[model samples]
Target: MPLPEDAPELSPALDPWEGLEPSGGQGSGGGRPSKPGPGLHLVATPIGNARDITLRALDVLAAADLIVCEDTRVTSRLMQIHGLHRPLMPYHDHNAAKVRPEILARLAQGAVIALVSDAGTPLVSDPGYRLVVDAVAAGIKVTTLPGASSVLAALTLAALPTDRFLFAGFLPPKSAARRETLGELAPVRATLVFLESAQRLADMLADAAAVLGPRPAAVARELTKLFEEVRRETLDSLAAHYAAAGPPKGEVVVVIGPPTEAAGASEAEIDAALQAELAHAGPSAAAAKVAAAFNLPRRQVYARAMALKAAAP
Candidate 1:
């Protein structure tokens, strides 16, 4: 989420609103563009810090015909703090089906609408995707204004690999479902991020260890708040801690590091590497190279090598 250094300057607080506007028009956006376009603006609000709101986001909110949010009270508080009052309408999961048509009608009439989640970015663990899909299908312009996100926040301090990471979101609550989901992600080969209820933290971590083996993991809670905490340990140890100490308070994000090559490489990759070595070398020599390359056990590699050779012409 970075830009070229040569890009025209805007407020540094404008994390995701680059070039959308000249940083002015209404609210804190001190100047005015000669013209303003009407479309759906997907705005990102703060995860915790109220000061994290961007100047451009405030301007969009001020200029929009109406603001769609999960809760009017939440948006009203933000509006009060910024001294920018705009019309608010509820568009959460329960009423989205009934209210989406009304929102479309307004968009068709050239209304500039701003969509926001209660916290963080919109459509993250929310029901906003369908609206975006429908808007695009209806030829309505839709864009996003990114800002603070808990997912990124947890990732930064979790001390895990970010080169390749997967945001797996939340698993099912039941033990069997959670274990099944964990088994499915057992070989993701990247950091696995999940949002879990505070009450379910212990059971979830326990399931992760049993299904995911001894990979390094971190549990982050109460992020950006007074009592923020991030605990890093192996899957088994983290599970034992949470199980013994009970669930920690507030929102939680679990980040699990990817497995090492011995455990991470797929069966197909192991076999391919083995076959290439087996083509010219005898079974013992071929198995040694393949085992070293993938950091796998010699016995396993040698067994696979024998199987491949026996089936060969």
Candidate 2:
């Protein structure tokens, strides 16, 4: 069985799941396991370390009537390592429309189907959301067996503000569109997280530096594995580092810090800003918008707005 070009450069047998007790699947002799409930079970597999899987996830995978995945071979290899010889079928973006109805039919028939991505949790960046939506509409129960998430893993490693964060998914592949999108999110006051391909990482970092300015940022690569690395630096330095080093291997996530007090504009600048927002908004509302943007006092922004309005044509 040949691995796909996109298949992870990992052997499932390595770094065996530490907390999981080896249990029954096909020949797994932990003992006869209790049957998982019928309907759809969304299972989360490890992102890097193979042993990050949970005991309950193992039980569901073992008892599942069928295991649906984005890539059959990828999931098969993982199951083989864990000694869970469950049946597997493909359910990816390309073929999801055609395959989803069949999956729903299986659930309707009381099949305990487990849906998993090639790695990590399903439905985050994957195409599992549509299936989940349809399954719920068809009155099929959908239960998620929560475990191993790259988003959470990267956020924790990044050492940024955990109080608030945004997972922005992926940027557009084209440079122009990516920059424009980044510009739209420039005013956001929380840490920004993005999932980027290893090959495009350097370019993405460069664009973030150009559009988002020099906020502190972190690049987490090959997380939870032997070579796991978390590089925390300002956006400009990260851009420069990756540009010089070329793209590193494996999965990548970028976490960027929010704007600092310097984001506040001067009085003249605030007046110019209010000119645009004031025409469409009343003074109080307009000042509130500017105040939030710069974390300034609303009274000051309101006074500025009033002065700007009285002097206007």
Candidate 3:
């Protein structure tokens, strides 16, 4: 999708660490200050390309006494790219509970600590929510250095409605639960953004089509990197496409259009629609048709049809 001509040109010069105060005990006095005040710095890293990091993020990484990250190796590579050599520690779902206190102690000691994830912004479908929750409860100075985010990047790439969107972050693993989740979100008026593995894209799309009807959607993958691709189609069409071709490679973001405005229906009108559908399709199919047509509950329509069936003859 072509960005608007007026859209701010996103460039590599956007780095925040270009020229700033030296960090990590570099002072005019040549001696470390007693303690850098306590705070938690939320840093954002590149989703794919290495050069997408910000200069301010580099400054924070260099200045902080210690850095906590989802993957030490991943963050290490990022820091190495920026020529930053700070003490990096692993803080993730597996050990977050055990490491939270240690991080708190550092903050309590007035040490500036930086938190980052393997990719993109922290706490975005990634770990670090609990840490932030705990830090806020402790009244610690928590600040964020925003930069690249996969969600924003995908939204831009998908060419979908960005003014209003809901990041659903990964659907349930099981089909039933996934369908229920889709059903629950079917009425949302905002464009729905979902993070899904390549393998499950087809099934998710199918479930979304069944629950939300044939809405327009886009499947974006390999974002910000070489071989990036965005496939746009109606939900049902996309489902069939993927179902036949199988899933594609790389991470995927499924962006779905919002629900269409439903036309008002009278009970008599619904009954008539149901009666017509029932003649050929069974109760379930009839209910599904009426539900899709009027955007109403299948069960409710089914019950009403049953009552009508009971009253007939």
**Residue 295 accuracy (lDDT) in model 2:** 80
Q: Estimate TM-scores for all models.
A: 0.76, 0.75, 0.72
lDDT of 3 by residue, 1-313 (tens): 4577799988976877766554334444435434445699899998888888876676678778999999999888888887889898899889999989999888877889999998989999877999999988988999998999888888766644566789999999889999999989988877899999989989999999888877767899888789888887678999999999998998788988766454755445776888888788777788788888888655455555554565458
Q: Mark the regions of model 2 whose C-alpha exceeds 4 Å error after superposition.
A: 1-32, 262-313
Clashing pairs in 1: none
| Per-residue lDDT over 1-313 for candidate 1, one digit per residue giving the tens place of the 0 to 100 score | 4456798877778768555545654454556743246889999988777888987787788878999999999988988888989899999989999999999889989999999998889998988898999999999999888897889999877766666789988999999999999999988777799999988998899899889877667899888888889987778899899889987888899988776567567655777888999889998899899889888666556756775676579
Across 22-51, the per-residue lDDT of candidate 2 in tens digits comes to: 555437776777898899999999998889
Q: How does candidate 1 score on lDDT?
A: 0.84
Model 3 regions more than 4 Å off: 1-37, 262-313
- Residue 184 of model 1 has an lDDT of 92
What would the TM-score be for candidate 2 when compared with the true structure? 0.75
Clashes of 3: 6
Cα-based lDDT at residue 3, candidate 3: 75
Model 2 poorest ten-residue lDDT run: 259-268
